[model samples]
Target: MTDIHQDPGAATRQEPGATSRRVIQEFWRLRWVAVAVALVGSFVYWPIIDNFRVSLTHQDIFTGETSPAGLENYRRLTEDPVIGLALWNNLAYAVISVLFQVFGAFLLAAIIEGLGSPRARAFWRAVYFIPSAISTTVTGLLFYFIYQPGMGLMDGVLQGLGLGAWSRVWLGDPDTAIYAIIAMSQWQGFGYAALLFSVAIQKIPAELYDAARMDGAGALRQIWSITLPMTREMTGLMVIITVTGAFQVFNEVMVMTGGGPNNASQVLGTWLYEQGFNQNDMGYAAAIGSLIFAVTMACGLAQLWLNARRRVT
Candidate 1:
């Protein structure tokens, strides 16, 4: 009773209709999910578009006047000395953060991994990670007191060691302010990176290390050959995290310095806050936000591409 020969064209026409019907049914079934996704996407991305629009306009926060300024704000950003200093400070912070938070964590993880007893390993891991568990705001406040001019712990320690000449107001001096902040950040953040590295290192097969040891490789040689190679991916990930965190650094800078001591330690986040809220330069602040978003996205994408390429090879 097949009517194939009777009307072959009829089946072809029905096939397209059937396919379209199925697609419509499927979309209807998942309509709520699609709606939720659209809602979330709009909620997340609308602000970004609005921020860009504001950046292109000269919107007075006080008088509520709005005018198109085109690229004037961006041009002013280029000429702004404070912006340049903030950029440089961000770069320095990234470098120092990578050196201490990422690499330092790797070293600590390696040492902990080499411990003979599981109890000792667990103890040290907890000890190192405890600092990271403390609230960052609390850590900043604690360090603020620790860096206080005369009666702080650092000054006391330096004086006790007969190094009084080296202990002059760590946070007060422009030369040492940023570095002191960097050190505090490292102390709080490195342990987290170390814990992650420790987990990655533990996953690496013990047989690899055992094989190296049988070849008369000492601890240093084993680490160089075995440990480092195994944790390469983790190191890459940590570097990306540290760099992004460095660029977006705000809490510590806000709590400790407020970009003070003549704005010597101004970073993009604090600078954005200063311009946007403090100075009522919302349009310019939006521009700075756009720049920070662009740069962070670019760096993240570049890192992901490089990591993927490295994996492919």
Candidate 2:
């Protein structure tokens, strides 16, 4: 009987020196990635772990208020009615912004995708992306004037067109302030989402389109099936980006509304800023910060889980 160990395939597997050399080569080739990952992790964990420790064990490091808060701050998050309202408002704002930005971006990207010449595509892409080039502070300020009651642009045009009844105090009224801000964020953010889709769409093989056309798929049908399905990974990533960005919105609020008209537009980030900077309630504000961090991390992990599942397929 032939010895199993002496078989040709077994000899190939037993090439010890080759395997060792390959491992060594791979280690050297990938050593920089390991170093980079380690360096990045150190910074990430330092702040997260430190912030968690600080939140749980509040010490006035400067003013001597160190007295193991022991979940007091976290407990306050649930019990404080204002905090609850602010958090609910924040959720509402994020949902509104994400819905508008992602949906608008996807629509715009779809309209422009593969339909334009290279020069025309670049032109519209730049046009859409132009607002994102402007600082959020500047854009907020610009829109602040645009929505002014009578002296401003919209009001001016409305007054000119005898559509005075349609115009309202866009920012002054609580009923419309958050929605207006949502529009501003969407306007600035849509370009980013479109650019991401554009980059991903470019990599899709043109042959796929040719195949779809041969099957007599109309542009809309082709988009629903071929374009969107193939770009599901990109869509998931863009949704995560939109959601995280929505949560972090602060600059526009600071410049235009300042969570004003009696906290009508109070999102979590704005509330945290108001507390920490305005009220000087650093401890309480830090708790809000922690919550924001948690929400962002949850969204990130959800995105990761989705991506992993797609890979498994």
Per-residue CA lDDT of model 2 for 1-313, tens digit only, reads 9865656676457655898898999999988799788887788767777776666655553575755776888887898776776666667766776676666676678777767588888888888888888898889989999998888898999989999898998998988887788788778887878877888778778898899999998988888877787777887877787778777778877788898778887788888888777775666777888998988889889988987787513
TM-score of predicted model 1?
0.90
User: Which residue pairs in candidate 2 have backbone atoms (N, alpha carbon, C) closer than 3 angstroms, thus clashing?
Assistant: none
Residue runs of model 1 more than 4 Å from their true location after superposition = 1-14, 18-36
Total clashing pairs in model 1: 0
Q: Highest TM-score among the candidates is held by which one?
A: 1
Q: Pick the candidate with the highest lDDT.
A: 1
lDDT of 1 by residue, 1-313 (tens): 8755677576567654788899999989998798787887798678889999999888778899999999988998999899998988888999999998888899999999999999999999999999999988899899998999898988989989999989877787888888888889999998899999999999999999889989999998988888887888888898888888899999888888988789998999999999989988888998999988887777788888877777612
- Residue 288, candidate 2: Cα error in Å is 1.0
